[model samples]
Each structure stands twice: as structure tokens, then as C-alpha cells.
Target: MPQFALEPAVIEPMVEALGFELVDLRVAGSAARRVVRVRIDLPGGGRPGHGVTTDDCRRVSRELESRLEAAGAVATQWELEVSSPGIERPVRFASHWRRYVGREVRLKAVGVRGKARATIVAVPDDAHVALEMEGAVVTIALEAIQDATLVVDWSTYGKREAGES
Candidate 1:
């Protein structure tokens, strides 16, 4: 709903070059002091590799700072933060569903029965997500989703794969 100082169009290339996905970008505060927070997503379950590390944050922060300085983009001084979206990252876009396929997720819909948790079985299209919940699969239209995010199950990844014998 709110616009960002660094538009997605300008940030996408920089994010991709750093081997991270640009989850979101937002600007906070008014004309006085602004804070531009960029949420980055890492590759393996949003961890380090192909993700935003401490060094990555420094590099991106410097780059963005330099770019903004050069362009004279902001009317006032702004703080730049480049960091991972953390564990409870929101899956807001269609690309998120595609990227997180086969992963467990929690979803809340506006007029749904109740909150639902399930594995993301598929992304039928840009408009819907198929989830597997308690042996039954449900396809939820994206428009209905009030909030959704990947469910971090440490045991799910730590456990042995099926048919290990």
C-alpha cells in the first residue's frame, strides 16, 4: 500500500546480483528522518547461502547508499537497512508460492473457516495456491488470503527422508 524510496524496479537487479530475493522494500517516516528497510530472502529455507548475510547486508547497504547519494534521491538523510525477512516472513506475492512449493505454510483467509496450516503442494496459477492439510488438499484463491507465511518446522528438515531403507 505504501511506496518505497527504492522502488522494486531499482532494487531487483541489486538484490539478484547479491544472490538474494527482494521480499519487500518500504520507507518509514516523513520528511525529517527516513528509514528505508529492505527485506531480503535467502535461498535454502531463507538461510545464509543465496541469502542475505552480514557481509551481504554491508555490501548492499553501501551500494544503495552510494547510489542514492549519487542520484540525490532523498530530500533528507535516510538510514538504510539490508537484512533477511527473518523466520516469519510473509508470502505476499505469487512468486513466493512458486518458490516455496513443497514447504509447510500457515495461511489466514478473510472469510475462510479458520486459520489453516499445510504443505504447499502446488501453485496452480498466479491466482491460487494448493495446500495439503491433514491428508486433504485445498486450493485457496490468493485474493482470499489475508496473510500467509512458510511454517518453519525444524524437525521436518532434520528427519530422515521417506523410503530411507
Candidate 2:
């Protein structure tokens, strides 16, 4: 069965109740090498730079594991991993675009191999984003985007953050 089948009944609600956003979930490998990787983010943020901590990951992991088992989402032995979306976090949903507006992003579209590095100006709607690429504002449909990841400028952000402290 597809992973989406369990979102409504298990994952989405559980993650929301924990005050976190579900970043990504991947179930890979075969029956013998099963792996379930889950990425989560704290909306209000906890750490200075990152929005989550080790404890948050552990807590979510424990809760999700129990829920998954109870829901019978996993029928066999599987390795579960839960972690925070790091500096280079993947933007998986339309909400993500609005959340990280003005941040540098790398977008990969279908039929296009190269990733476009640009700054997000606005999330015009759920299906499109306005980006400032090469000094020009361009709009791209979210559906055509295969993947979008935030590009962190650690040095710049760190320096700015330090000054504010």
C-alpha cells in the first residue's frame, strides 16, 4: 500500500498534535532491508538556528513508533529514523514556500536536470511561487517542481544572528 494511505489516519494528526510539521517521510529498501525515515520541524522553533533539537527528534520518534505499530502501518520489521530538517531542509509542501520566504532556495523541476538557485519573493498561491532568479522575478508552478531545498548561508546568518544577541 502507498504511504499516503496512512497520512490521514496516522501520520498527519500525530505530527500536528506534537506541534511540529512533517517535513518528509520515506520508506525504502526491501523486506529484508526496510527503512522508514521521517523528518520533522518545530513551527515556532527551539534552537537558535535549527528549529528542533535532539530531544524533539527522540520524542517524536517514540510517539510515531507507537502510533505506527498501533495503526499497523508497518507489517514487518522496519528501522525507523526521525530527525529535524537540517540547514539544507527540503521544501515539500506549499506552506513551506510561505514559511521560508526570502530565503535562498534550490528548485528542481521535472524534465529539467539542473537545479535553479533563487530567492523566494512570494508564494502566489498553493500551486505557484514567485522567485527572484538572475535579478528577474519569475513564477513557477509547484507541480512542475520535483524538489525544492533551502540553501543556507551559515556565515551570513550566523553573523547577523550574533549581532542581534
lDDT of each: 0.75, 0.79
Per-residue lDDT for 100-145 in model 1, tens only?
8998788888666687788888998999988898899888898888
For candidate 2, lDDT tens digit of each residue in 7-69?
423576798898897887667778765788888888643344657889988999999889888
Which one is best on lDDT?
2
Model 2 residue 10 CA deviation (Å) reads 4.3
- Root-mean-square deviation of candidate 1: 4.5
Model 1 residue 47 CA deviation in Å: 4.9
Candidate 2 lDDT (Cα, 0 to 1): 0.79
Q: Kindly state the number of residue pairs that clash in model 1.
A: 0
